[model samples]
Target: MLTLRDYDNSDIEALLALANNKLVSRFLVYTFPYPYTRADAEWWISAGVKAEGDVTKVIEYNGQFAGSVGIARKTGWRDHLAEIGYWLGEPYWGNGIATQAVQQMTDYAFSDLKLQKLYALILAPNTVSMRVVEKCEYELEGVLKREVFKDGQYYDVHRFAKVLKI
Candidate 1:
């Protein structure tokens, strides 16, 4: 079973194990360092501790840290929109775990936070991640050209969003 919860200090080690993989990091927008360290994990938890509102969350599978997911709200006309980002451990990939975690988080963002919409930007060539977003019911809004730079190259991203009916 999959669950979404607040991040805790003890999760650092396991979280680092899941996040440090180069294969996992490649699909994500953010670039994790080559050797992800405990200190890196500690620094992340420190920031998570300060995160409030639509900010941070951890994915738990059977009481252990499985991965992480969070949202950041946009400004100006994008105020009501919050962009979500997530990644799972390489060992836990291909299961419905991410789908369940994202579904629960999106529900909370809609019903609890009163967010108008939740969205994600998936890099082109990451077919697996694109499928994950589709399974979550996040429709592809459009393709963003040269929107993000990763691995010293600019990649086009597919924009996806789901407006809440609630």
Candidate 2:
């Protein structure tokens, strides 16, 4: 069984272990730090998870910390929208865990958060994530060429979104 819940102190070790991987951080934003250290995990659980206006949850599979999923509300004129993001441990891949988690987070963003739209900006090479959002019913919005500069190289970004029915 998979579940989403708030992060706790116990997750620090698992989080550090799973997050400290080049394969995992390669596709994520630069802020996600490649060498995800204990301090980073500590700060994430103690403060980052509680960032104002954002909702983050730990993805637990069979009672073990498997990954993380979250939504960040857009500000100002775009307050009606939010950007969804998620990542799973390499060991947890290919099991439909990310797809299920994205579906759950999408529902939560629309219903509980009352957001009208949720979107994802996927690195062009991250086809697995593109498939995940697509499976969740997010439509391809557009592609921004050379939009992201990561790992000393420029990569395209694919924007995908799903709007609330009303």
Best candidate, lDDT-wise? 2
Candidate 1's residue-wise lDDT over 18-130, tens digit each? Answer: 87888878878564564677887898888844555456788888887888888877778778889888889889888888888888888888888788999998889888877
Q: Which candidate should be chosen as best, given TM-score against the real structure?
A: 2
On residues 1-166, what C-alpha lDDT tens digit does candidate 2 reach at each position? 9999999999999999999999999999888998999999999999998988999999999999999999989899999999999999999999999999999999998889999999999999999999999999999999999999998999999999999996
TM-score of each candidate? 0.92, 0.98
lDDT of each: 0.83, 0.95
- Local distance difference test, candidate 1: 0.83
**Any runs in candidate 1 off by more than 4 Å, and if so which?**
none
Error of 2 at 5 (Å): 0.2
